[model samples]
Target chain A: MLTYFVTETNWLNFISSLVSQYRVFGLIDYEGELKWRRLNEANSHSITITKYRSIQPIKKFFFPVKEEVTAEPSAQKTILIGCKNCDLNHLKTTDSMFVGSPVSDPYYLKRRENTIIISSDCDDFRKTCFCTSMDEDPFPSKGFDINLSPTRGGFIVEIATKTAEQLISVRKHYFQDPQPILLQEREKMRKRITELVKNNNSELNWTDPQRIVSSTYNSKAWDDDIASTCVECDACRFVCGTCYCFILSETKDIWSRIRTWDSCQSAGYARVAGGGNPKNTRAKRLKNFYACKLVYRKENFGFYACTGCGRCIEVCQGKIDIRQSLAKLKKLEKNV
Target chain B: MFKSPYKSIKAELLEVIEETSNIKTFVLKPEEKFSFVTGQFVELSIPGVGEAPFTPSSSPFKTDKIDVTIMKAGYVTEALHNLKGGETLGIRGPYGRGYPVEELNKKDVLIVGGGVGMAPLRSFLLTLLEQKEKFGRIILCYGSRTPEDVVYKYLFPEWKKVKGLEIMQSVDKCPVGEWDETVGLVTCLLDKVKVDLAKTVSVVCGPPIMMKFSTTKLLDVGFKPQNIYLSMEANMSCGLGKCGHCQLGHHFICKDGPVFTYEQIKNIPEPFA
Candidate 1:
């Protein structure tokens, strides 16, 4: 790993240089909401390095909402920037689902292989943010090609992978040895952001989420509370970084096979012909969705599926907060 | 880089056998040699239409051709039924765990299949018959909706002639025809057959309700959960298990099993539900 201090002006210039070589995507303000957009020479100045997190997760870069698995791989290289820690953690779950074992998804693997990831620290927290409750930090500790921590007038950059190291070596003059005082300031900023997240999510009860969720399989809170408010719009699943369940359909003419994002909340997700559906009711489907995040995925993939990005909370039309639901599940566990 | 699992191998439809009013068995010859053990399934794709999982009904030993019996119940199958011989389609696997025939060598076997569920069981039966001398008595109790819905009707007479094999069939109702066989649920046939409960391994595949009721009856007849196998089906998109549509609890029906012993999946939240 190589650490350097790059001035804001030089950092923007490096980004501009990379934009000419790779398709650079970063966070920018769109209608007051931070969303991912391609960073070009014209808009490189407006790119934010300290946004909480992008509204759209980094999943779309590697696993698009829809793609043809049999199609040719893209030739252009891609660089994703300004990714938060929560989205980076989600890469772990998606990796296991798409890249592991007896069979792997070639489409996702191709995109992942052709892309470089650049993550940044979160300087602030949203009202819906709850990564700390799920035992994840707001800033990434690992699993990125490059990491940027906002400093006074520049970025404390850490090159974690050989790909990033090679990319920076081409424009080596822009990077300088970090001063010890600036490094200390960067560490303080990281800690302050972590504390802010913990304090913001303090009201939510935290426990062994896996144990609580497994024991509360029959909890009335699912039907009596969560189910009542859930509109089944599937917005949360669509926005989630780790919800990789997909449906394979053909075009109307039947010439091409298409793989598109699917949601468990949908009525037909688990339904088979002759109408045998395990998760038939909306309440059961909602319960299964949470169980997938808390229990089922952990048992299968060795980790909780939820990265606690809070995107689901923001997009949910029913105002049904997953943090609140997990808290309620904990209370129900105690009652039982 | 490994080849994409989603890529389907081409197979030419050799012949179509109409098993029932709405069900047809399409015999296909893969462009490449495809081999699978009895009780395994393959994803059949109609180029532009879509793909769905169907276990080959043909004997695994007959590598030249494969049989897939489909019911005209869904959109994909509806498209499949409209296809003719000499047309090309795609096939992906021999996915999921097949029946454990090697373990059942010296044990008596009881197979119960209902409706189109008989397709996979047919493969199991034909394979078991190839080495009939190695196993004890094989009893198959099949049921369907009506006389017109009975599949493999042409093969029953020949199957009865096998040394120690017994075939018993029942229909839920007898239409306006000369129906001489049993006219009750498949579970009723279990009472008429005699077997040493300690030595029998039961395999069942059917509609959800039939499987549930038949499993209860099998239990009532003293069949151990470990000795019972089920060919479970769900909406499978990617036969390699990348797609999560076929997931049941922590198990991927496309990977962990399309065939699981009752004891293996009994504790999972909703195996039968």
Candidate 2:
């Protein structure tokens, strides 16, 4: 809850100071897309805080697209900036999948332990963003070390953990105690962005995703329009923040084992070695994906797997919109 | 510095028995004493090839060496079958819940296996035999494509000699004079057998289609869903449960099962598939 004021120039200097010790990555808005780029002391000044999350989730930092499971993942001390609340909240699912499982993934755990997350508020909104619909705010309240709230001339840095406090302690000159009016400004910015997200998603209806998904388990919508458009490219799964499925492969000489991202959207995901797949068809596979995201995950992990980032909608190969699928399944008489 | 569970432990192939044309039983001597309960499986690997999950057909009581019965069906199994003997292989696991031996004590245990599905059951059967006096009648009904495709033909005589155990056999068809046993569907044996349905528990393992038909047959023959056990198989990549390949609805087969009761998973769609 402790808030501080860091001017635009002071904030850059503070980030630059840490470059000698930590590998700092900041959001660089370029070519109409916001991407995470490594920051040295020189490039730290060029780091631009974005209003939304990047196309890549924070998971790629922990669970890479491919890694050698046979060796140790580099446990480099690092800091990540420009993480939105949607990006931070998605870790609830990924953390449990990687760290809280019966056997933890060593690579993911190592990276998680070594990284310090600095998330930011969404001063702007994306058309596809629907965090408000999933009971999430545009700003982070937890699962972050420090959160930056963009105000008129600077960022309102809210320190949440001892690590953040200690990290800030070394560069105390860059920060000043926030004025009462600046605190109000941060809250106002948050409210405006939340409203923007809500308005953008107002047209799409399923208030209770859990109920709607369960009721539509046997709906004709799955086999109807969905079957034709779904090419099963697995783009949605690969870009998702919560899809943690992976497959293991051996090197040609068997000297190493590589763990690569695998998606259930693929036909052979649940196939047995003997040529039997429970989710054989595209319809069955798509149903499984939705059931896991909305119903089964909540049943097992006590939370929905979808992060509400709307990345799936953007990256979908077949131009299939999940919102349309829900609308098709929705009965006019019942909200579900 | 935490060690990854994906890494397979070195194990030397001590011996190999050619069970049939495609089916083979491998006896492995792991560098360490790898112990597992009955019905639990291990990820076996052929050095330069790949890994596949299989239940140890050897007795759980035997820790010095492990036995796995593999049919040459896929890439890894094909590589495994090509090995004669005395080749170094890799293994990881002893994952998933094994058979509920404590629950089966003093109760009649009926085992239904189809073809290579008999591999995991052999471990469960051996465990029961070791303490056969502690349980009631143990019945095994097995069916294969033909007499030639039957695995562990050498063990049937030894099993018949054991007290409190009854074994039956069936084949899909008889090729002229190739067979002389029960020639019909395995479900026929399920119908003919006089089991005290009230006190019996059944464990079924086979190919997907066979598992489906046998489960329906068990239900029809007066067996309760809770009493029937099924050895479910999916594409299990990481035996430690992090990789999500072997999911059966909300439960991961590698962690929550490989062994599940019919009552536990009857609700999941295409569970046997």
Per-prediction TM-score to the true structure, in the order listed: 0.95, 0.97
Q: Fnat of candidate 2, please?
A: 0.72
Q: Which candidate is the best by DockQ?
A: 2
Please give, for every candidate in the order listed, the TM-score of chain B alone compared with the true chain B: 0.97, 0.97
What do the candidate models score in CA lDDT, each in turn?
Answer: 0.87, 0.86
DockQ of 1: 0.58
Model 2 chain B, TM?
Answer: 0.97
Off by over 4 Å in 2: A253-255, A332-336, B176-178
Quality of candidate 2's docking, in CAPRI categories? medium
For all candidates in order, state the fraction of native interface contacts they contain.
0.61, 0.72
Q: What is the lDDT of residue B207 in candidate 1?
A: 84
TM-score of chain A of 2: 0.95
* Candidate 1 lDDT score relative to the true structure: 0.87
Where is model 2 chain B poorest over a 10-residue stretch in terms of lDDT?
A: B1-10
